[model samples]
Target: MESKIKHLEMVENIIERMAKNCFTLKGWGITLIAGIFALSAKSTEQKYVLVAYIPILVFWFLDSYYLQIERKYKILYKNISAKSESEIDFDMDTNNIIITESVAKKLCYFRCLFSVTEWLFYCPTLVAITILIRILNVF
Candidate 1:
């Protein structure tokens, strides 16, 4: 039982680490794309501004996927932590917990992209991208 608890804690830590990395990568992607556009805006083709959206969107959706995975593992952690020693096992799988939330089980990157929390984070960048694309001729 003690070993099972320790193993679950270890799994939670791993998931937390990955989740932090996902957010870090997303922030870096935004920074890099913005930097590329800034550096090349004057000398490069104006249309290149539109290309920034590609990575931005990709990173945004990818971050959501990571968040989904993190949420699942968090759920599993809670479930395991709540159980009696007799109920806990070494199997530590998250799929069974996710099944109860069929909608969550079916969630894909594209769908997660539009999740309210994700939209709150990424939509403003998308708005900025659209405005930048519209004004590319001015740059």
Candidate 2:
């Protein structure tokens, strides 16, 4: 029983780390975009605005990857919670777990990319970039 608890705690720690990574990625994405925006404004170069897309897209993919991993761990946590003590082998690798078809679809890369939380941050950033590009071109 104690071992099982410890195993669950380990899995929980991983989930927490993944969530933290996603948060950190969001912060970095915003900071980089803001910096790029400043550069574009100061230089009056649309190129900087174009460069901003690299970080935004990269961070978006990374954030989605972390979210996907976090979700897998959540599923693993649920599976572990339902298992017998003997079944709790303290295995933290989520890839070993057999996910169902529907659940697997939800866990895919593109699905994670378009997930509500991901889209909420990245899509707006994209729109903002587009707006910036237009403003630069007009002025």
Q: Which pairs clash (backbone N, Cα, C closer than 3 Å) in model 2?
A: none
Residue 107 alpha-carbon offset, candidate 1, angstroms: 5.4
Clash totals, every prediction: 0, 0
TM-score of 2: 0.92
Candidate 1 per-residue lDDT, tens place, 23-138, comes to: 79668878977886886587556666767878877788678878777777777777777778887665657677634556565455566667776788788888877887677754
Per-residue lDDT of candidate 2, residues 1-139 (tens digit): 9988998999999999999999999999989989988877788455767888899999999999999999999999988988899888888888887788999999998999999999999999999988978877834
The global C-alpha lDDT for each of the candidates, from Candidate 1 onward, is 0.73, 0.89
Candidate 1 local Cα displacement, residue 88, angstroms: 3.0
- Go through the candidates in order and give the C-alpha RMSD of each one to the true structure: 2.7, 1.6
Task: Give the lDDT of residue 4 in candidate 2.
Answer: 89
Displacement of residue 113 (Cα, Å) in model 1 is 2.3
